[model samples]
Target: MTSTQRPRAFRIPAADQTGAIEGDVAPPSTVRMVEEPFEIVEAADGTPVPVAPKSRAPWLSLLLVALGGLVSLGIGLSLERMISDLFAAAPWLGRVALVLLGLAAVALAAIVVRELAGIWRERRIELLRARAVEAMATRDHTGAQAVVRDLAALYAGRAALAGGTKRLDTLGDAILDVDDRLAIAEHELLSPLDRQARNAVATAAKQVSAVTALSPRAIVDVAFVVFSAVRLLRRIATIYGGRPGFLGFLRLARSAFAHLTVTGGMAVGESMLQQALGLGIAARVSAKLGEGVLNGLMTARFGLAAMAVCRPLPFIREPAPRITDVAGELLKGSGAEKPAP
Candidate 1:
């Protein structure tokens, strides 16, 4: 009877239990569930955001700012007239005041002109530099050399126009500088033992030659040729580049002539403005009998002010952008993303 006893029934722990007994085999151990880290994914369907354009301070806006000063001068003159009876008693003093004002105005105008000219020259230099870089990149040595020569010539002409021997010297110095740099580059390229290096050097040399060949004499000739061509084309464009109608022809003529006329008129206007400023100052000073002290003082003050505005003084005006904006625009237009932050 004892031998026939039923097999012992054993209790097993549930799947969640940790400890196991010898009589009871542990139920298959439950795998401890682990949570994998959640990854943040960017949305593939999102539209690319457009970059904001750089805000440039408009040249016209700067011109207008200077106009404000001119307007203030007018206001000051009007005020002086309104208080004329007080000044009338001392006609000499009035005359002196007038002379000082005139000198000041002439000085101011001259300074502004000089500054504007400098800005123009700087812009031209930047343009030339860009052309040179392009020519160099394309292995157009001739073109690069031509650009360098032209730049040097331009600097020389500008210096001459500025009435400074130093600037003239700068022009010669610039030419020498370009020659030295080209020579160095040429040497590097030609001296390389590797065939690849030699080829590259040869290519660079060709580009250098292109730029260098445009000597001062050649640049002058090319400039004359271009100027003549432009004038001729402008005339032709005026006559023919229009719709087929009497009114259209007239419009076309006017439109074509507009730029030339405006430029000519501006030149005349500037000259007249300068003369008027000078006359006004002279008339005012002549009426007063103080030694040239008032005139000299005014001139000195005005000259100083003008230099402050015109010269490339540090921390006064930020340098104009050269390549960054142009490169950015090119990249954007080509549907390329900006370089990573």
Candidate 2:
């Protein structure tokens, strides 16, 4: 054991620990080459699905229906219990309860009907608008006229659109050009409504900017922003003659928020670009004021997106308002301008 312990293992220095052999030469000088990325147009398409779409399971829909039914049943039972207790207590009380319940039920039923009707109308408008856009794109004369007729029917009884609807009716089929028909519909009909819609959007944007700027609490700012955005969407829909019910508002919100999502990147890029271009409006203002201005711009941006979604027709004649346009107005209104510059 002592004799074996006398031999020691050889150790290499940490600096020379590389796996290079004795005859190996140093590697050639490193080249600083950069490869630019390029995209190839992928010609191959994805395989089409042969089966009917079942992305959503049937059980989910069943679950929703069941949940609604359970809620309704619970409410009915509670109401029944209350009414029965009243009856047991006194005949007069029971009679009054029955009348009140009947009235409430009737009112609820009316509201349900109205809401359903509103959703249907909104769906009809959306479909009609899509058809019109496609017709315009394809230069489909017959299809365009059909769209005009449908649009006129949609706006028929409104006193505000009486002239435009009548004009559309009177000019039926006379204008064979798809462009002309769409233009007339957009300008004569949507323009006046467009102005009203813009005014509403500006008002909402102004209010949001003011509230968010003055409010001391972040929660207040957030609450007001959400309230204003929803109210703005609802107001814009109303201007376009859309009676968006709760469900319909959700649909509109989905589209509006989708628009916002797509433009969100551009919004960030725009601010960055403005700074890079030496037009740093944010730099000119105090931090809180800058934050307020940014929030105002975001609100205006959302308002613009809401306009695109809620407006049945595409922005054909009158262009959609730009973020800068709205921001400039907001800045002026709020007295957030650079002082004596």
Model 2, runs deviating above 4 Å: 1-56, 265-280, 331-341
Q: Please give the range of 10 consecutive residues that has the lowest summed lDDT in model 1.
A: 307-316
lDDT of each: 0.39, 0.75
The whole-model C-alpha lDDT of candidate 2 against the native structure comes to: 0.75
Off by over 4 Å in 1: 1-74, 77-87, 154-341
Kindly report which residue pairs in candidate 2 clash with one another: none
In candidate 2, residue 60 scores what lDDT?
84
TM-score of each: 0.27, 0.76
What is candidate 2's TM-score against the reference? 0.76
Q: Give candidate 2's error at residue 273 in angstroms.
A: 3.7
